[model samples]
Target: MDMEKEMFDIIHTSEFSIFSLSQLPHDDNSLLLGYEGKVKSFDGRTGKIIDLWEMHEQRVNTIDVHPGNSNLVATCSADGFVRIWDLRCLGKEQPKSIKEVAHNRAVQSAYFSPTGNGLVSTSTEDTIRIWGGPHFENLSIVKHNNKAAGRLSSFSAIWGWNDSYIFIGNIQRAIDVISTENNITTPLKSEYMTNVPCRFATHPYKEGLLACAGGGKLFLWTKM
Candidate 1:
């Protein structure tokens, strides 16, 4: 027996490989993409370029949308920086990044907090950074091992249900929770965990429920 497989080209305008992309809020057709060291917006439904601009000196690793503000987005890059951009300033301005920081040697990813009031970034330089306040000048850097997980998923400092706690994996085969308020590190270890939890996800509506995956293993955690 033979099984037929088919593939369709949904986008044709972009000649370069897209590293990361995010759909603009409130508009299903609008999309933002990071490719060839540039930030670009294209019509998702039509596959037409809406706009393009030079964004970073190196590859953009991730594009994250603000949880509260549709107009705000964040991008992390191997250029060692994380920048915050305003979607509202699209055609009116070039280089719409309102805030940016030289986080590390290579930032793996950046994410806005659940409230959109704070930002966090994970870097390959073995550090986790937190930025907040009006100017985003209030910064705290926590030293941690964030090296690439060989043959496994790398670690990302993910926010829990709220903006106060960040969940990440440690070399001790346990989960580490970093407090945003005081910049403290706490470990969550269990006898059942056999491997490191490199990637994380928290229930948006649940307070303590957490999940992490690494080495093709998943662990669900809850405060006892």
Candidate 2:
């Protein structure tokens, strides 16, 4: 409750209103923020903005830094573009996009696989696209029911431990898993899951556990 209230206040503050945030890998003191159409890096301890990069025509919905390469970061936005940025190249007024794909519609989430060789993105409608290969081309399009969730932090497809399994919530009160290698869809249902999960987080050490949040509650799932 306290954290939610704090976030509510922060979102109302124009100077601190953030659409998305990301933590830079291997750098403990730096943090990344997607404010409006710009990306900024700040000193986490001092609340000082160090650098900024212009990004996205619309608000960035999600930002995911490549797990293997910290220099490679990805973002999806309402502007219908999913992009990868090389953080080594920065310009607040003219940020360079290393690579991008035109979704042609608002994208909700773009996440890199744990191996960082693959990427998975969720759209506002019916498609979940997976990108891979040397250039991260559009590899496959999987059908999914993602039209339900509406808020800023809504149904997002996420990766499990390795690069094989992807997790996303459905309206049926179950978690859906999409296999990247075999291209199979599976549903994970539990009687304890009463509400549809909208957001997910993973722990660094506990690779076997995943947590999901919705309805002001959190559910932790373990692989056993």
Candidate 3:
């Protein structure tokens, strides 16, 4: 199917290139979008800007909505910071709270745990940091040396089964699994793997299943 040719609707937006976008978990009518140093929420159906604010010193990297609370959102940035926003105060000019200097280099991505009680962020500095609570207090940090190339090919971390582990790719041809309980990291062994995986995703409904991509190739792993 050609989606562009069979489109149902399209709503033009402001003239800035969006770096990342996330829809509120429970709201089909709203969307959160990030661009250069700023974040905005818009009416998904009408393309109307509901709120706007500058929360980063550089380009915003990614935005993730809390799974349990649709009003809560997390955004990471090229300025090495992560911020928590409350959509209840959507018109405010600043984030409700922030973790200043959350990373030493550009933060590539941030995701809230499926339980919405933990937040994890990855950076170009070869580190992953975890925070606890809906308020996002810093909890632990895991450092690695995956010096893979290219920002477009950068790695992302995601919470895996039971929110007990975080899965990420390293410079080596293997995935690194970090325990959320004790901040320990171990490599995933498999018959097939993606070398220097740049991005990966966990199956939404299937436990221990993952898809990884890098170097023009993709690999799927089952049962961790």
Candidate 4:
């Protein structure tokens, strides 16, 4: 019998600290990293930077790659804006589109829809916004009161497999299943958990299977 071996690999080092990171959806060897008011793409295998830019005026909070188009990246920052970047552009260029004041307070997270035609952003102001197009037209807004700040401010949200719905965590220790078409929120039952669920991820290959975590515990839920 052979045993599995573990190895540690350092991809890149820099003077600045990294706050957020996301890999290109189609490329495992590439990554998008967020640091103090800046974002960059690095080749993980070679430890060489592919592109770099000062993206925001404050520390970037989150980065998400477009599911259908890896070249499109979405980033939110403490400056309260959500900017979409085209990775094909040169390092010195500006974002392809910027959602100015996407949230009234510091933006916590921003993600591209699975279809890559829309974007979703959450903020410390207890609001989640949906946007469409490169110009970032406001499509919808869902409000909830989960006001933790700083490192704890960020709550997870992701589109459903078919893009018909979104799953968001709330302060009340449950997940909110929101309908994209009607903007209705239904709380998922979580009576067994003692703490608020701060993050959620749907099963990649199985429908109705979800994994959520917070307060040092993980919970798995499936459709009944």
Candidate 5:
């Protein structure tokens, strides 16, 4: 189907394309959105754009509010940097801290780990880089593939389970569960999905309930 048809399908299914989305800490009623380089906070149910900020030099690739700190927001961009911003501050204020080389290449995705201790990011460089905190500093970069060419296309997506294990998805239509318990490299089980996921989100209050946007359909996975 084409774009119009897709829109119709989404409307019928009670969903829409999200350019970039983040849930406010402790307040599900508010959402932070990044669309076309503009950031806005809105009432989730009413669709009201409560606050707006436009400071990114390029299109925003990701937007995440600090899990325990509602005042802070983190964003990554095509410009090759990750930034921590204090949303409580006013307009025209730049990010509190900007990591100029947060990623070697365009950051494809970024997210705060569920436990609120740090951030997990992925880039087109085909590597997953973990930052110790929202500052995007004190980082450790994990190369997903040992081979050079393989690493180039070996992109990744990440989600956390109690900060103990992070579920990573990739273009290969496979998921890798990484354990943060020992900071060791061990490959766990992989789930073969029907298609590369277009979007993914974990349930805030449920165990093993994964909301996956893939294969032109939505899936809810439950743990056995």
Candidate 6:
């Protein structure tokens, strides 16, 4: 990959009242910018504010687009809610609908399933909840870690090679290989980095090579 090439041509720049950025799927040319309790979609080419949607009555934390389909995206807020949007039907005579109350707490990550049929999100409650459907309905909940007071520090990321497996990450910087066929979650061999992993990505064309980064460091690994 040419790191020198511009990713998203920074179509717009605005002040946000939040902590992080909620980006749309890379394949698409749109970005969802969250600020002070609302969400807006910006054009990736011209940096024009194309569409806007209200997600919460309070501040929002993050937004994420679906991996397979760019039309669908997810958002989480400080008000402890996760919402999904279908951008395809926006601003029509009868536009698409948004799903609110998707989660119970301040969500950390709201991610779509690799197959685009379902989604998974993590909360401050220390539980990972999975939802189904392109419409996004509740499906299953995975509770493995203990909850702590005053915002427990946790990191949860998912990597989907296919519908069969999703690699999950934890605060200790270790990963769990989740088998979607049987819902079996197994921890992978630890990388032993200096800090916990904050991001995950796979090779564009190679199936076994994977990359992860955290704490100002990057690491690449290949499956044998």
Every model's TM-score: 0.85, 0.88, 0.86, 0.88, 0.71, 0.75
Candidate 5 lDDT over 1-224, as tens digits, reads: 25766643221111333467777767867877776666777885665677777746666778987778878777877666777777766465443443345566777677777767877777767677776654546677666641223323234456656766666554455445666555455542235456544456778788787765545656566778
Q: Per-residue lDDT of 39-92 in model 2, one digit per residue for the tens?
A: 777785676787877788888888999988898899999888899988887666
Give the per-residue lDDT of model 4 (tens digit) for 28-124. Answer: 8888889989888899788898778888989998999878777777888989888876777735765545335456788878887777777778887
- Clashing residue pairs, candidate 2? none
Q: How many pairs of residues collide in each model? A: 0, 0, 0, 0, 0, 1
Give me the displacement of residue 219 in model 6, in angstroms: 2.5
Which regions in candidate 4 have their CA more than 4 angstroms from the true location?
1-4, 91-101, 133-138, 149-153
As a TM-score, model 4 comes out at: 0.88
RMSD (Å) of each candidate, 1 decimal: 4.3, 3.8, 2.8, 3.0, 6.4, 4.1
- In candidate 3, stretches whose alpha carbon ends up further than 4 angstroms from where it belongs are 1-14, 92-101, 150-152
Ranking by lDDT: 1, 2, 3, 4, 6, 5
Regions more than 4 Å wrong, model 5 = 1-18, 26-29, 43-50, 93-101, 133-136, 145-156, 181-192, 211-213, 217-224
Better TM-score candidate (3, 4): 4
- After superposing all C-alphas onto the true structure, candidate 3 shows an RMSD in angstroms of 2.8
Error of 1 at 195 (Å): 2.5
Give the residue spans of candidate 6 off by over 4 A.
1-11, 18-29, 67-69, 88-96, 133-135, 146-154
Candidate 2 segments whose C-alpha is farther than 4 A from its true place: 1-16, 149-153
Q: Give per-residue CA lDDT, model 6, range 129-189, as digits (tens).
A: 7777656654777774523323433455465666566665555655666665666788765
For each candidate, the alpha-carbon lDDT, in order, equals 0.83, 0.82, 0.80, 0.79, 0.63, 0.65
Count of clashing pairs, candidate 1: 0
| Best-fitting candidate, scored by lDDT | 1
Candidate 1, lDDT over the whole model: 0.83
